[model samples]
Each structure stands twice: as C-alpha cells, then as structure tokens.
Target: MIAIDNKLISDSVLEAQFVCDLNKCKGGCCEDGDAGAPLEIEELNELISNYEVIKPYLTPEGIKAIEKQGKYIYDTEFGWVTPTVNSGICAYGIRDEKGIIKCGIEQAYYDGKLKWKKPISCHLFPIRIQKSQQDEDLEYVNYEPRQDLCKAACKLGKQLKVPVYIFLKEAIIRKYGEEFYEALAASAEVVKK
Candidate 1:
C-alpha cells in the first residue's frame, strides 16, 4: 500500500491497467448496480438544488423514480446513495441514442447548467473509497476490477500501457489535490521500477 496523507492506496491502483470501453460495456456500471450511484452529502444537496435543471435530461421513468424516491436514499449496506429506477439504473441516468446509459448530472454539467460534475464516487469509478476500519478519520482507496463490466477496459489499458492511477488521474486530482496526485504519481513510478 502507498500511504499519503490519510489515504492508504492499494498497490493494485499502481499495477492494474484500465480504461473504460463504453462500446463494449455499454455503461453497464450505471445500470447493473444493486443501488443507485453512491453520493456524498454535498452531492445529495446538489441534486436537490439542481433538480429543475437536471430534470429535462432525464427519462420519464427516471423522473418518476426521482420524484417518488427523492434525490437520495440510504441503503443499510451502502449508506447514502442516489435513488435507482426499478432497483436498476440510477434515477439520474439517461439513455443515449446508442442505447447506452449516461449520467444526466454530467450532461447538465457539460451544458453549463451546474458547476459540479457527476458525483465524486462516480467520477472515481473502479476506485471505491471507504473509511479505514482501524482509523475512522483515514480512508482507503483501492482498484476494484470487476471482470464482467471492465474486461474490455483492462484489455485496452494493457494495450495503451495505462496503469489504473494514470487512467484515473483527473478523478484522483479532483478528489484529493495536485500534491496528493503528484505523490501518487511518484509512487507509481517507483512501483513500476
């Protein structure tokens, strides 16, 4: 594990390769999960505040789900998460012309309707963070590779020689900071050697 600040990053984050292949997976990560996308407390507030702007981009079913379930829900197992439609796709998800699920919140951000992108958890995908059991104030960041949804990404990452850390640079920097990411990048180079 590479320790920086309060985060303990798994070595797999440096060794594993990944790059999302949306064509192959068809954004299955958004649809196949048990619950909606995970959300931070602030993100939940953002959804509530920006619902009017985000509504136009949602599907009828997604809109209904969000209306009925509110912006976020608490799962016994997962803590707080965005609401899901029919217990499948996230209520904040919309289907593209290609029939692939996409995040409505992200689309709104791209359209300049909102300042924040999608939830930090969704942005830092395949790298889930959890508070350390031993130290509540500390967090652990790990590369979690699910073969069914991410096989193509793994193959592509290997082909492109992109490690998980490098592939997720933007999200990492967004979640942590430039100095934290720099430390991670430096550690990745050492691990590579």
Candidate 2:
C-alpha cells in the first residue's frame, strides 16, 4: 500500500491497467449497478441545487424517479446515493441514441449549465475511495476494475502501457489534490520500475 496523507492506495492502482472504452462497455457501470451512483454529502447538496438546470438533460422517466425518490437517497450499504429509476439505472442518467447511459449532471456541466461534474464516485470509477472501517477519517484508494465489464478497458490499457493510476490521473487529482496525485505519480515511477 502507498500511503499519501489520509489515503492508503492499493498496489493495483500502480500495477493494474485500464482505460474506459465506452463503445464496448456502453456505459454499463452507470446502469448495471444494483444501487445508484454513490454521492458525497456536498455532492448531494450540489445536485439538489443544480437539479433545475440538469433536469432538462434527463429523461422523463429519470425525472419522475428523482421526483418520487428525492434528488438523492440514503442507502444502507452505500450511504448517500442518487436515486435510481426502477431500482436499476440512476435517475440522473440519460440514454443517448447509442443506448449508452450518460450522466445528466455531466451533460449539464459540458453545456455550461452547471459547475459540478457528476458525482466524485462516478468520476473516480474503478478507483473506489472507501472510508476505512477502523478509522472513518482515513480512506482506502483502491483499484477495483470490474472483470466482466472492463475487459476492453484493461486490454486497451495494456496495449497503451498505461497504468491504472495514470489512466485515472484527472479523477485522482479531482478527488485528491494535485500534490496527492503528484505523490502517486512519484510512487508509480518507483513501483512500475
């Protein structure tokens, strides 16, 4: 494990490889999960505040689910999370003509309607940031690639020689700080060698 500040990063973060190939995966991570996308408390508040702008991007079914279930709901296993449509896909998600589910929040962000870019958990995908059970203040930054859905991503990463940590550089920086990502990069140099 590589310790950086309050986070204990998994070795796989430096060793494993991944790069999302949305064409093959078709955004399965957004829809296939049992629960909705996990959200931070601040993110829940942000989503609520931005819902008016983001609502236009979501499907009618998604909006209905949000209206019925609230912007976000408390999950027993996952804590705070976005409400899902029919207990399946996230309510804030929109399906494109390609049949791929995309984040309405992200679409709003891209269209300059909102500042927030979806949930932190969604952005830091495959690299799950779970709070340490022993110390809630501490966090585990682990690389947890879905074996079934991430085959193309893993194959692509290996072909490109990109490590998981490097592949998720922007996300890691967004969740952690520039300094923390720099530390991970420094460690990757030693670990990969």
Candidate 3:
C-alpha cells in the first residue's frame, strides 16, 4: 500500500478516519460508467499538462467513446454506445484469470509512469463530486448503490465515512491544481440528500 501525506483543507480530520473497502467495491466505478459532472476545460487541461505520460494511455478511442456518447465522462442515463469491451468492465480494468479485477492505471502508477494516474475521484473510491455550486464551490455526493456496499452494510448515499479527504486532496492537487483540488474538497463536504 502506498502512503500519501497531506492536510485536509477542512475539518480537524486525521488518518484514523479513512477506510478503503477495496474488497467490497470490485471496481464498481469503472464498470458502471457515468457522466460525472464534467470538469472545466482548465482543470482537464491541467491534468494533461502536468501528467503527459498518461496522456497516451488515455487513448483517442476513449475520447471518441466519450464523443460518441456525446460527453467527456460516461453517464448512467445515456448509457454507453460501445458496451464495455470486457463485459461492461471499464476499459482500463480487467479481471485476471483468478477473477480479481486489477486497475490498469494503478498498475501503471506503480510501474513508474506516475503520469498514468487518474483524477482524485477515480483514484478515491466510493466518493464522488456530484455537483458544483455557483460560489466556485463544489458539492460532493455519493452514488446510489444497488445494494449495501460497505462491510458495515451501510445504506447507499450515506456518507462514505472513509476519511479520504487527505488522500483525495493530494490526488486532485497533483493531477489538477490546488485551486481545483480545493474546490473538490469543498464539494466533497455536501451532506447526502
């Protein structure tokens, strides 16, 4: 496991609060495509500029897939035109013969091409930025699960309680910028509706 250190922009949170339900998630985000609230062009550009190595891995095919779908990010309501090649599995993910799904980007990151990493939301599971507010602030929200997802069997849309703010903050700032990262942190704070 990789250890990343950073202070959360809000709250007096600490490392003790975060929990990654890796076993339970089963790569749900990649398999279940959704048009996340799109990022601004500047933010997207920052990711590309600061992390150019992964740019190649981000195949034009993926962009075309998004374009064909009429959006940059996949969404549930619109559905994918090209069904996930691996039986609805995300393009960069694959389940090994042992039936364990491994994340390609994460693998690449460990392989030394750190540029092949994902945005914070992609890297930080179970937590997503659902909406952006007008004050340049954003609202983060959890996705509605088909069933209970946590080991605690917590209901969907309930706060993830994973204490991932610091991890996410580092990821967002590294890929995007402190500004975009700050907005995302604020967004992540929205109470679940």
Mind sharing the TM-score for model 3? Answer: 0.47
Measured by TM-score, how close is model 2 to the native structure? Answer: 0.97
Flag the better candidate by lDDT, 1 or 3: 1
lDDT of 3 by residue, 1-193 (tens): 1112222233322222444444566545566654342343444553445434543444454444433443234345532222243235544455655554665446667778775454455554444434434534444334332244433323211255545545345655665578766655455455221
Looking at candidate 2, the ten consecutive residues that score lowest on lDDT are 25-34
Q: TM-scores of all models?
A: 0.97, 0.97, 0.47
| Model 1 CA RMSD to the hidden true structure, in angstroms | 0.9
Which is better, 1 or 2, measured by lDDT?
A: 1
User: Tens-digit lDDT track for model 1 on 1-193?
Assistant: 9899899999999999899999888888898877888888888789888999999989999999988998899998888899999999998888888888899999999999998899998899899999977888899998886768999999999999899998889999999999999999999889889
- Candidate 2 per-residue C-alpha lDDT over 37-121 given as tens digits, one digit per residue, 9 for 90 to 100: 9999899779878889999998999999999999999999999999999988889888789988789999999999888888989
Name the lDDT of candidate 3.
0.44
